[model samples]
Target: MHGCFWHRHPGCPKATTPATRPEWWQRKFDGNVERDRQQMDRLIAAGWRVGIVWECALGRKADGALIDRVEAFIRHGRDLRAEWP
Candidate 1:
């Protein structure tokens, strides 16, 4: 299931962001990104699908439906790669 069960605490050391008192926003953010990468790596290695649901996507805006995006990713992720023009 692509590490889908490996949920972390959003901002914890393993997930949650550092509390205001710690004042380690940048470090925590970087760590979070890195951990996400590692999770992807492990998932890929295990031959599973990985779908990342960003926090901001939950709200209505330019991105639109979170479910739609996730569905599209799941349906097309394997055959997809970034293209820059």
Candidate 2:
């Protein structure tokens, strides 16, 4: 699964959230998103396949893109598969 590391385990060695202030954390999250976008673009430009797994896409819902998420994973062999609580 491909996703911002922070969203996976915030404060993990591979992830982090700004701690100086709450707003800093928000900016940090935004930066992570932008960085992830750039990384995807770079990977695509390099001819590598990229699949995104968003934190919110894992929920079962009456009206949602859950099927799309499954299809993406099945067809692409990758996903931003975050196990949200």
Candidate 3:
């Protein structure tokens, strides 16, 4: 599971920048995004299926739909990449 802020989850409210040290935070976030991309690329090249479950998707409640989606992905997903909402 990846934190929306650290992983730079697009359109996520949790992905916010701190008021202080904006430049430093940007650099850190950029590096994190780049590293994640590189690792994902390597995994894909090695014929591994990749699935990313964002923190926002896991709410306080136990969502049946989310669990089902994850189960489906694990059991029968054939795509190169899959990400949760």
Candidate 4:
């Protein structure tokens, strides 16, 4: 999920909601999170393992580590939900 500020990414500096029409942004973010929740539930019901690789993980210093983490997730089959280091 290549989400933007719409998903309300926790602790990410880039995930700030729009300033204009704060109420509308809140409603939109609420809907976005709800949709993500429903989709995640369906995927879990289907026995699919899900992982969230945040966009912040793709940067100059962290990109290499992020790739390694992704490879480990695929190869080792471990449940992981990593955040900013």
- Measured by TM-score, the strongest candidate is 3
Q: Which residue runs does candidate 1 get wrong by more than 4 Å? A: 1-23, 60-65, 75-85
Model 2 Cα lDDT, one tens digit per residue, 1-85: 4443554444345455455796977777777767776887788688666655544434465434665555655587553332322
> Each prediction's TM-score against the native?
0.49, 0.44, 0.95, 0.80
Clashes of 4: 0
Report the error of model 3 at residue 65, Å.
0.7
The sequence of per-residue lDDT tens digits that candidate 1 reaches over residues 1-85 is: 1121234334323334445755567565566568877877787788777665544334356444555666677777673321110
**Candidates ranked, most accurate by TM-score first:** 3, 4, 1, 2
Clashes of 1: 6
Runs with alpha carbons beyond 4 Å of true place in candidate 4: 60-62, 80-85
Worst 10 residues of 3 by lDDT: 73-82
Candidate 3 residue-wise lDDT, 1-85, digit = tens? 8899999999999999999999999999999999999999999999998999999999899999999998999899988889999
Measure candidate 4: CA RMSD.
Answer: 2.5
Clashes of each: 6, 3, 0, 0
Estimate, for each residue in 1-85, the C-alpha lDDT of model 4 and write its tens digit. Answer: 5455766777778889777999998998899889987887788688776777666666667477777877777688656333333
TM-score of 2: 0.44
Higher-scoring candidate on lDDT, 3 or 4: 3
Which residue pairs in candidate 2 have backbone atoms (N, alpha carbon, C) closer than 3 angstroms, thus clashing? 1-79, 52-80, 53-80
